[model samples]
Target: MSEKNREGKRSARERLAVEREKRKAADKRRRALIVGASIVCVLALATVVGVLAANAGKSGKSSASGPATAPSGAVGKDGLAIPVGQDTAKSTLTVWEDFRCPACQAFETAYRPTIRQLADAGQLKVEYHLVTLIDANLRGSGSLRAANAAACAQDVGRFGDYHDVLYQNQPKETQDTFADNDKLIELAGEVDGLNTPTFEKCVKDGTHDSWVQKSNAAFQSGGFSGTPTVLLDGKNIYADQTITPAKLKQMVEAANKS
Candidate 1:
């Protein structure tokens, strides 16, 4: 071959090699940018999720700690339960409830009449322990606030009346209506003398929040499964689907005779 032809061919080969290397470098740079952008998007999404979680946790109030001051005449383990009916009654019914829990509300609506009759007759006594299960599970403070307000009512010897009133007017489970102090105070009008300044102060100040938190902690630690845990003389009668209001009354009457 001619020397000139050979030189031209070699130059052409060198140019092709250089063009290929440039394209490879450009492709590598584009891939690096794409990876960096993906990492940034992931990080931003994580931050957004973190912010939402924090906001949900901050609604209305926070989990309480330190010493717990219970309502007046509270009894039972750690003084967490609010007692109803005569202490001298023959049968003791223990109830664990959360105001924002739909099952608890249903239980109260179905059994309250019979329970009240039994209590008034001095045959049965009921002890109520309030917890904040809904607040923790649903991410709101209505359960905590309502429990605190109930404790406040207990302070003035009006707990039973106010407790019934609360259940009668309970809001939807998903609604955080009870979280507002003004709303709680407004509802006190349903119970005579429950709207007093002392009760109002107690409700607004969250006087029994720590106590409510303590009670909820106990409920969670005790391994019991859900709200409205009604126990009649140490038996979880609420879990027994066969039990009815009349049956409960009959059981209490039998216990009174025993």
Candidate 2:
């Protein structure tokens, strides 16, 4: 080949090599940008999740003053309803509930039988904590009213029966039916001796209103996120997704054995 042709070929080869290197560098930059963007997205998502978790924890905590004083006949000092079992029961089941919460109603309806049986059998003591989250969310007084009426029932030595009746006759979440004192008295009639003049007076006057507020504050301080939060011997039963309504009896039995 001629010298001039050889030189031209060499220059062409060099140009092609340079172009290939440029393309490789460009691809590297694009890949780097893509990786960096993916990492940023992941970090942002993690931050959001962390914030949400923190908020949830904060929402669950109870107030500093703790739960209100238990009513005259209530079993515990913290305004909880009278426990249904013997004082030496093997397990303590603490339930945080809202009268207007559908989930709370569902839990009551589904687990009432098991809970009642356990209590009656003296295997466990069930403590009820009334909260007013629904009242705050729905802008109604039903939750507070119902809780107050329940406390009145406690004063009359019929808290458990009245509590069950309240759940059995719970109004729809959107309806503030329990807000009516007459309705509360009517429901009280379901539990014998709970519809007396004094009981009616208590409901009408919201005698336990302050107690209900303290109960809610206690619930917040408890670090519970929502209604029907159940604790077995002070440990959260629903925390790990292992316990369900059907498994509650078994869990109680296990706790008793343990």
- Indicate the worst ten consecutive residues by lDDT in candidate 1: 40-49
lDDT of 1 by residue, 60-172 (tens): 34335435888999999999999999999999999988887766766777678999999999999999999877666666778888888899999999889888878888888
* TM-score of candidate 2 relative to the true fold: 0.70
- The per-residue C-alpha lDDT of model 1 at residue 241 equals 54
Write one digit per residue (lDDT tens) for candidate 2, span 85-119: 67788989988788777777666766788888888
RMSD of each: 22.0, 17.4
What C-alpha lDDT do the candidate models reach, one value each? Answer: 0.77, 0.68
In model 1, which regions exceed 4 Å deviation? 1-63
